[model samples]
Target: MSEHVDVLIVGAGLSGIGAACQLRAGHPGRSVAVLEARDVSGGTWDLFRYPGVRSDSDMFTFGYRWRPWPSETALADGPLILDYLRTVAEERGVDRLIRYRHRVVSAAWDSATARWSVVVDHDGVESTITCDLLWGCTGYYDYERGHRPEFPGEESFAGQVVHPQFWPEDLDHTGLDVVVIGSGATAVTLVPALAEKARHVTMLQRTPTYIIPQPDRDPLAVALRRLPERVRYPVVRWANVLKLVANYQLAQRFPAQARKLVRRLAEKSLPSDTSYDEHFQPPYDPWDQRLCVVPDGDLFRALREGGASVVTDSIETFTPGGIRTTSGRELAADLVITATGLELKLFGGIEITVDGEPLVASETMAYKGLMLSGVPNFVFTIGYTNASWTLKADLVGDYVVRLLDFMDARGLRTVVPVREDAVGERPFMDLQSGYIQRAVAWLPRQGDRAPWQLKQNYFVDVRTIRRGEIDDDVLAFT
Candidate 1:
């Protein structure tokens, strides 16, 4: 491979791969290289292997733009998603540009040279590469660590403890009493799958999360069958956006009303004996924390079917046989699956420096949720907070190509967000999700208006990013 390239993408995941495809399709002869941290591609899909793992969103829009999901169902399992990503990478010829097992350690921008010097560790040896543009598609997934809570006597407990993030391939669960801790998407997915195979599955959650039940068969299945790829894809995509927007608007304007409607929906799918207010009702407002969607209430069905059960209590400590609850109950478990949420890391834990000045994530302002203040010739893709991740990511990819195309036409080599002293009134993350709240200290903060604000709304993003002027006053060009 060449030592230098026009663009150096720092991930091989969905967004990164999508960016590569966009760049290739727009500018066919441009030299681009994708540096992946792991040995294989498929970022989230490759990392997660827990049972019942699938896209919470419909796969119709979740799959790549160039590729159509072959599954009859719109929501697919992990392996199928990985295969789709691999297919897209191969078909688009982006796989050849990826250098696996190369983790970017640090990137420094040189003002004089108008290039970025990126240091990466391949296998064990470290090397430096220079590029005109540094595009970070390293997604928000916690690659560095998993967020597992510390229980008293955790080390002393004799039971095997495993996290779903790093599930062992050869591990056996037959006849084992499995205790899953947490109530997020991961926990919900794991509990139902393990309950079927294990002796018993217990879900211990401290707080209840709003759960919405979806149909077993994907809603998009009919569309895929009746509509052509050209019509089906856009229809599904817009439908997803409309649904997401309606949900968001409901959550924002009338949270209580929305919650009641959602609770009623859940109750309709659940057993008659199920208590919606106690088991399903969330403390926070709807969309304050993300409402997890269950595929046909499988998790609820698993609980109702008797192999699985829910324990709405805090874990006091780890006992010899299982977990000891704060309510003075001891749950027996041969295996413990910590389905706790992921640990968030910024820029894939890589240090960013601007002209030898160390750049902290919190100090940098986001420009169109892509470029950072005081960072030049760099573009990163951060998707929607409430909807399908790919909706915004795909738009960002198209925007990046457009921006680059504009630069080419104008004979511009450098693009950077000009820093200012003004502060913003709005919070960086307006939502109250645990993942966002927990990582607020480590996350990037936004400012008042353009270049610093992050609009989670898809329509605003599409207009500002896709059709807006790339060479604006806020973004300095040379």
Candidate 2:
């Protein structure tokens, strides 16, 4: 027998739990169920077990708007974020809505009944659920595995090889010479953390990333601790929000100036002997890829203390002792960490078919960055890459609640975006990153015009998603 619900949320992560809470409060008449493939909540936070794993962005804006973050620390640790998520779930009764170990295999939309037949697999048994609306809050990355490229002669390496995504809890880096490959956020974060106990640490990269210094704690939050959470949280949150917005916009508007400014900041933070042009300079403009934030210049401090070093070169092959770069330089290592990148996947890699037809993601255009063209009663939650993720997520939650309320008032059972034939196609994600580039063919397309384009700006999203009218001619309702 198939269980029935008004909404079926696929994932009990940060976004999924938030969705459930909003639906329960906003539209209390509806029945909701959150399907979590893993046994735990707090998706990414619970999965990543590496040392010093923390928020890349400040926690104030990253935290949900409904529940103000209590931490004065701007960049919260992974365990703290997990606790926050689980706490929110428990307090809001969202934990009761989650069905753990329920991996949704496929969703089929029945046009006659206007309901989704969702097939899920759990512990070698398959079950089904019917819902009026199906939400894909599973995030864009493949949790089953991360992006791992085959390095030349990596098998010959005498040391242990580790990927930051699937980091083993038992694997210790104490008194070891570690070489971490890649110049992404993960690599930068791991460098200093590994340097704490490791004999030596080296961040090996083909190109340098834009590294900016951020404070570990928010001084404003600490100062205003005497006030209640409702009073002080918003004050600190907006301050950080404006700061991030200004940084991103400045970088985008004046690339050269921003580039020089960032390099100068890094130079001031790094050791005097560290060559800025050779090691700190990047070839591309800022914000092309996401910037890496180091709290209180921890990465730079490690470099100054001679605990960690940065190397800019290509990896030719892995030697018995370590790795050999294209420049014929060998990096001695006892443990090699491959902080390559993430693998992008849509809707938890679940198969979607509408009226017996397979839904090709690449062919569809996103509707206001929430729903897809020609897909009915379905929405996916994807956060901003430039700013804090939850900033955009909270806005999306508000828009969804409004949408459902609008539907209920009109007695509408189905809502789908009618794609404009005249619109030009672009990649869903505007970033020029390796992971996004690899998943181009698998992801959906965006448009060049309004309501179809995926705006990375948080303020623009607030105006459109938060306060904008929902009943535009672009969406078809039945």
Candidate 3:
């Protein structure tokens, strides 16, 4: 027999748990169930087990608004993040509503019944669950596989190759020479962490990425912790938000000045002998791609202490023991760690069909960065690329609950964003990163105007999503 529910939440991660908590608080009568593909609840936090895996953004904004993050540390590690997520789930009884290993394969919407028939794969068994509303909290990355670029002569490499996404537990790197391929957040993080255990660590990148050094513990948060969480949470959260906004604006408005400022800051953390322009300076301006944050200047410290090194070059081929660069330089390594990047996938690779017709994500336009145009009774959580993901995730959860409440008061069964005209379409994410650019063809498009265009700013999103009118003309109700 098919199970029935008022709402079926896909992916029991940070967003899913937040959504469930919001639903419980706002609409207590609604029957909600969360379907998790993985055995564990913490999605990204649980999936990535690599050394020095931590939040790129500060925990103050990264954490949910409703639940105050207890840690004084602005940046937290994977285990701590996982613990926080699990605590929220177990404490709120959201764990009871989740079905582990229940991977959603397809969702078919029936206009006649105004419900979604979701087909889920539970281990090897397949089952169906019908729901009035389907909320997709599955993040925009392929958890099954990280992006591994095919290097020439990779088959000839004798050493064990590893990806940060699927880090092996028993793969010992003690006193071994490690070469991490990528200059993004993961590469920067792993370099310092691995430098402690490995004999030497090298961060190999084709081009440089903007790196910023930040204090692991926020001084403001440290002082605020003396007070109660009720008094401290909002104060710290807003202060961090304001700081983020000011920094973002400075980067956007004055690119050259911002770039110089960031480079200067990074130079201070690096060795006095090392040239910042050669190793630390990126080709693009600030915020062109996401900046890598090094907590307490860990990466720079590793470099200064001669534990790690950075090489900016293109890989010609993977040699038997290491990599040969285009610049005729060969780097020897015992282990080649591909910190390359993630493969972006939407809705956990679930196929969506409405009235027996398949829906293409790229063809559809995103409505307010949450719902897709022409998609009914469905909402997906997508956070800001430039800011803390959970900040937008919390807002999305609140907005969704508000939308549901609006529907309940009006006796509406279906809600979908209807396109009024042929709006000019642009890429969903305005990032210049390799992973985002490569996946643009498969991702959704954004319109040239409001309601269809995504406001990447959290401050703007808060006002628009939380305080803006829900009964807009663009959204059709039935």
Candidate 4:
């Protein structure tokens, strides 16, 4: 059986939930349905169950703009984030519209009918659904399995090895020597949390990453909580946004000065004898890759208290009980954790076809960072890399609603971006991170100019996506 709807939203995560709420409020007459591959509604929050799992970005800006976060704490844990997501879905009646375990396999658009034929795999059964428009909110990573680099002698290691993505519940690390691989946010977080239970925790990294301590509780947020929700939310939200923007601009304009300031702050957190430049200082400038956040200086405190340590070197091979580095030094461990990184996946690895022709992402240029060139009646929500993800996500939801309203008013059946001239092409993301570099070939390209290039700045995106004109010459409506 084939079910039909006015709009079909993929994924039931933060972006999807926000999009559903916006659609319901703006166009109540439009019938909508959400397809979630997982059984739970909290996408990333529900998937990651590792120790000390929390948001790297502050909650005030990371949270939805429409709703004020009830808690005053800026950095939140996984459970609290999941609870907030559930609350939003239930309160807005969006939960009832979601179909769990329905993974979208492929979507084909027909210009003749102006509808999309979507195939979904529900458990072991195959089903079909048709919709006038398709909105993709699946995050930019592979959820089924995280990226795992192959070690030369991984099988020779007698100790228990675990990846944070597939952490076992029954596994115990208490009183065990643990070595966590990588120096990203997950590695920094796990080192501090595991130090509490383990005999010792060692964070092994091939290269250094920028780390900064953030206040776990915001004093201004706490003070503003006493006022009404309407007055407190906007004030706190803009304050955090401006602070982030100013810091980013400073880093770009004065890289050397910004680097020195970050190093000084990191040194203050570490012990007097420890060398901050040897391990904490990254080779790349600040904002090249995302800056790691440690709340209340937990990671530094662990190092100072002799609970955890760090080693910067490449791994040669895994030995019987530990790993041997390229420097020929061996670190013994009873447990090895790979917190390496994520594997980028576009549109939940779903295939897309338009009028019987396959659509290659790399060949298409992004249109306003929301829609793709020559792709009709389709939109994908991707957030900024430098700022809170939800900040751009909220704007995307609002812009989608506006686009739909415009189409209805004009009695248009299809819309797509048509490039009129040749524009210089660049990679989708400008970051030098490994994950992005590995997936560059599989991702889409961006133009050098506006409306075609991705403006990662949230303030610039707000002006263009929020108040910009929808009826441009580049956009063709039929």
Candidate 5:
């Protein structure tokens, strides 16, 4: 049997749930169905179960605008966040609209009918859903698995191997010496948390990241749980935004000051004799790549308390017993946790096509970081790579709802992009950051224009997305 809906949402993550909530509220008579690939709907939060799994950004701006978080802590762990998402879905009636364990395998658009034919796998059976509009919120994280570095003789090493995404539920680390690979956020987070249970936790990193330790608490959030939303929401949100902007400004305009402070912290955190010049300093400027934040000097405190530590050396290979470092040290480990970072998957592995022809992501330009050129009725919410992801995500959501309302009022059934000849010919992707550069080949590019280019500035995004006219000729109305 087949089902039909006014709108079909893929992946019931933050974006999907947010889209559903707004769609239902705006058009009360419309039927919207969200299909989640996994049985659970927390997306990234539900998938990553490593110890001390938390957000780098404060939950104040990271949380939904409609429902403010009561926690004072800026850094929220996985369980709390997962619980928050579940609560939002349930409270907003989004849970009822979700079809759990339904994975969308393929979606083919019929240009003649102007509707999407979506194929989903449900409980070992394939079913189809037809919808006038399709919303994708699959998120950037690949659910298939995370990126694991291939170590020489890793399979032969007898130690239990684990990744943060697929952490063993029953694996007991008590009294075991553990070695975690990589120096990204995941690696830094695991060191502090695992040190509590493991005999020793060694973090191996080839290059050091710009690390800044900050107070993870939010004072406004602490005072707001007792107050009503009308009185508290704006104050807290604005305050967080101010701080993010100020810090970002410092990193952008006065890079030296930020670098000096980071250097000072590293010097104070590490041993006096330890080479602050060598092990602590990064090759690039601060914030050139993503700067990792540690709470309460957790990693430093763990190192002090446990006497277990950080080693800056490339992994030479895996020995029969453990890992062999480039420093010619063989580190013995009872368990190995590969905290090596994630692999980027564009649009959650969905193959996008327009008007019965395939759409090449690299060929298209990014439209205000939310929409892409040549893609119609599609608004993707990707937040600032440097700042809090949710701050921009919230704005993007508001803009999308407003755009939809504008279309419906005018009795428009379709919205398609008008490809400007000049914008399409320009080179789109150019960022020096390793993460962005690594996946540049796969990511959708952008051109130099009002709607085609991506401006990282929040103020610019606000002017463009929120206040912009909906009836512009570039965005064709049908």
Candidate 6:
């Protein structure tokens, strides 16, 4: 006898837990099982144990819409975020539904039976589980490792090289000089954090990223703390949502003005000796890439205090003492941290086949950025790149729930999003981030029209996904 599940969800991260919770709340009778590739429940949070791994987005919008966490801290540490995810899962009984260390290998859908044969690697032993509907929540990164580019002559450095993804818990940087390469969110976050204990820290970057500062405490959360949970959560959440939308819109509309504002802020925070043009200015316009957020100007404060410094140049090679720049400048350091970026991997690298035919992701179109066209009884999530990940995740969860409800009401066994009209293709992600650009070719493409393309704006998605009709011309029901 073969064990079969009707709704098998892959991953136990925020999106997975949110998906299960939505099913529990909206359709209590539905059976859902969550499969986590790792032993722990919190995916990214559990994996990242670095000194200052924290969320760049505010917790108000980052947290789930169905259940908001108690903490309202604007930018929360990794541990806190992990704890919140675990607590939410436990409180809603989603934890009981998760089977850890059961990594999905492949899923093949058979139209005749309307069931999917899912191959999973459980504790190194291969096992197959069948499902009527498959939901992918593994997120868009490889869990085992991150993107680590080999620097020329790195073996000659004779110093410790650490990647933020697999941060060693026992590694200590206290009283040691550290050189962190890359200017993304990880580098910005780690510079000040390592500076607090390390003798000195240098942020080495090929190019500059827009770094801005925001308050540690959320103004709305503090001001609305006196209000009831029902009133406060929604008020604060929506307010922040609108605020983010407006800011993103403004940046997109007037990129030059936005760039000038960022430059002015950086100039004021940084010391007079630091050249804003040389060390802080980026080649791209604002919103072309994500703006790194530093809480309370910690990064700039560290630089001003001489605890850390920024070096802007391409790498020539690694020297015995430290990194050698293309300008022939050598940065001496005892430790080297490569905060490069994530290795983008979709659906936990699971192979998908429809009726014995292999489904190539690049050949398909993303339907609402959630479901793939021509794939039946299947849905996947790719969160908002500009805003909080959960904002789009919550909307996707709702869409899946509503989709299930529609199928059940019509006595349908399968649903597939099929596009007939011709539309221009675009990359899955809008951001020009290095990680996305590197993996965009393999990822699925999005159409230029509605129901086929993602608006990315939270308000537009809420209307289309949350309350929109499910029985549209695009979705074929059987």
Separate clash counts for every candidate: 1, 0, 0, 0, 1, 0
| Tens-digit lDDT string for candidate 3 (83-156) | 99999988888999999999999999999999999999998999999999999999899998899999998999
Ranked candidates (lDDT, high to low): 2, 3, 4, 6, 1, 5
Candidate 5 lDDT tens digits, 1-478: 6688988888887778777777777676889898998888888888888889998887877887777775677788989988998898898898999989998877777767777788888898998888877777777667786787688788778878898889888988988989988788888899989899888999888898877676777677667768876777778887887887777778788888888988887667765555666766888777777878888778877777754688899988887678999889989898998887777777778766677788788877776677777666666767777677766776777776777788788888777666688864343434355446667786777777778776566777778787888777778767
All candidates: TM-score = 0.96, 0.99, 0.99, 0.98, 0.94, 0.98
- Candidate 6 off by > 4 Å: none
lDDT (C-alpha, whole model) for all candidates: 0.83, 0.92, 0.91, 0.91, 0.78, 0.91
* Model 2 clashing residue pairs (backbone): none
Model 2 lDDT vs. the true structure? 0.92
Poorest lDDT segment (10 consecutive residues) of candidate 1? 422-431
Query: Deviation in angstroms for 114 in model 1?
Result: 0.5
Q: What's the lDDT for residue 441 in model 6?
A: 90
Error of 2 at 18 (Å): 0.9
Candidate 4 lDDT (Cα, 0 to 1): 0.91
User: Which stretches in model 4 have alpha-carbon errors above 4 Å?
Assistant: none
For model 3, the superposed segments whose C-alpha errors exceed 4 Å read: none
lDDT of 1 by residue, 38-124 (tens): 999999988898888988877766776556666656567899888888899999999999999999999999989999999999999
Assess candidate 5 and give its TM-score to the true structure: 0.94
Query: Against the true structure, candidate 3 has what lDDT?
Result: 0.91
lDDT (0-100) at residue 340 of candidate 1?
82
lDDT of 4 at 204: 94
Candidate 2 lDDT over residue span 1-478, tens digit each: 8999999999999999999999888988899999999988999999998888899999999999889997899998899999999999999999999999999999999989999999999987999999999999999999988999999998898999998889997998999999999988899889999999999999999998889888899989989999988899989998989988999999999999999989888889989888888887888899998999999999999999999999999999999999999999989999999999999989999999999999999999998889999999999999988999898888888998999989989999999999998999998998888999999887899999989998788888889998999898998999
TM-score of 6: 0.98
